[model samples]
Target: MNERLLLDHLLVRGPASRADLAKITGLSKPTVSAALAGMEDSGLVHLAGEVLGRPGPVTSLYDVTAGAAHIGAVDIGRDWIRVAVADLRGRFVGRKDGRNAAKNSEDLVSRVRELAQAAAGQAGLPWTSVITAVVGSPGVYDKDADRMIFAPNLPGWEGSGLGDRLRTALGVDVTIENDINLAALGEHAYGAGHGIANFALVSIGTGVGMGIVVNGELYVGARGAAGEVSFLPAPEPVPADDDTLRHGLTESLAAAPGVVRAARAAGLHLDTAKEVFTAAAEGDPAALEVVHAEGRRIGGLIVAVASVLDPELVVLTGGVGHNLALLGDAITSRFAELGPLRPRVVASTLGDSGVLLGAVARALSQAWDHIFDLRQSGVQPRQSGVQYGMSR
Candidate 1:
């Protein structure tokens, strides 16, 4: 499996020298040399360049050849569908991001097809060339039913045959996952959570959710509802309407609309959450008060999560959570007053690309697994989606 291991590492981290690969995989010099020779003979890898300005001997770097295979990743949000296509070597081919106007399951399927095809076209590959596709959506995915649940923010998504429709439309193996969970994976692999053993990412956006990573792996509980933090009881009074109940309690208090409500109650004429943050930056008392309250609510949620899981880091993200400059000091003060051993809170550096990048990471994982399995079994790898059921 040395060649398999080398290829996988290169696909993830890009090109590297034999010494670097050996160091990363803990393989010896002779073992790495043999594996590289075999991979080069098989036409899977080629010499990219040589590193200069090193201490001693010059090192030759190898990269995976392009057009070996393709993977598609999609981020399906309430208002947009972002699509990206990458090759087996982890090189991006194309991307398409557009408004989501789907009102129901059928419309959703059509929109996904259109976006995926356009992305593949831009990448100079046919849509049929895509081998595997992973979709990051906003809900707890019930794999048994193959539909989304507890996703009130996405109207008409619950109980719909969205998953099967996507599979049929895309004509590839499809896997559905919670968007926030994907964001956590994105952050862990490429952003703030890198190198942290245990951490929690709390996203405050159109809705509130948490994604927990423990011991360098995503910890989705039985029935895939581990990080559904929005249902936690609200700390303050909320709208108390049927719609608000459908949306969770904590979410109604900490998400974007919650900020607007706090502003209006304080007699501020702000129209959106961004405006409120802007007003606060300008030193408006009413807006600053709302900002402080929102920070406290977020800080309380962080404390609650820390008390149970005790993660080392807490990454704040999403539409409301990413305003770190405004909320950072307030959240820190709230936690400091409470007690010791509180997790350090930080903002997401990945920004809007978190979900989509995570989808790509997951898709490449599955694709590589299938390729390795084919090599082991002496069977040719096909474009069909390899069947595997993973916890969301």
Candidate 2:
């Protein structure tokens, strides 16, 4: 208990001497000394440096061994796959980003494995050495079904036994989560939503989704589908086609593809949403109109979220949603046209790295828990808890 308490302090506040640890942790100096010695012998803490010109004897500072264990974070998106290896301190030691050209779930699994190995290699460690890994994808992982659901952007990703296959491929403990949810966590941990207790992250890209944070913790609903906002009803008439049914109305009308579709309808001749946004930035009237319409759609979505969540802020992210400068006016106008409720909105500062950073943050927490459990059980830290397991 003393060791864990001291270790937690060190992890949060950097290095501290035995006297300081005792003062902060409210333990006796002798108890702090014993705990630090035990942790040092276990390779979990190390003497960082000594304060030279102190009043009495030299005060030796100790810190958690950040490199004692490593964690892996993966972000799987429609257009890209990002992998990062981070130490116990949540600092990325190695990272790799690659274009995703996967045609099937099998290919995607293989690609993720390759990227994990490559990232681990860059960190001068083997992939097996990673204590835990968190994968951020675009669907709700159904533990009972052992497969992803509500993910239409990735082909063949909803197949049964998908979770097992990913574990087999990655050869480590893995947790699959919604990419947008992870982005919210990223913002809460390191970006725009930092220090805010209640906020929502709405991502408009290849697909539309939201992540909710309440009371400083993520709320994923009863079945982990809390923020699947794509299915919400829209003002625009939605087609009764199979594709529309699969992706839902709000996503079909508000996502990047929808932006491009509106741009083409406005005679902009743009193929991608990026192109449409670029044209709008270059002051094309047609493109601007399309963008404003898209923004209004997003604004409607935000209003719906605020009515229920009443979050302190709503962070807009993803490829199309990040253009808050262009979307702000239309969003505000739509807010006026709608009811009286208007939530604070801003663009995501984390960019494409949000999911990856969130994954790292979660993996670090898991690694710490595993380490503590092993230590309490009198087992070697690296012997168990390295195999595949779903995070609940």
Best-fitting candidate, measured by TM-score? 2
TM-score of every candidate: 0.88, 0.96
**Residue pairs in candidate 1 whose N, alpha carbon or C atoms collide under 3 angstroms:** none
Candidate 1 lDDT over residue span 104-199, tens digit each: 768777888999999999988887778789999888999877789988866678865778888999988899999999999988888999999899
Which portions of model 2 show Cα errors greater than 4 Å? 380-392
lDDT tens digits, residue span 1-392, model 2: 78888988998899999989888988999999998887787678999999998688998999988888889999999999999999888899988899899999999999999999999999998888788889999989998999999998998999999889988998878889989989999999999999999999999989999999999999999999999999998769878699998998999999999888888888878799999989989999999999999989998999999999999999999999999999999999999999988999999999899999899878888888887776776764334443322211
State the local distance difference test value for candidate 2: 0.90
Residue 256 in candidate 1, Cα distance off native in Å: 0.7
Model 2's TM-score against the true structure: 0.96
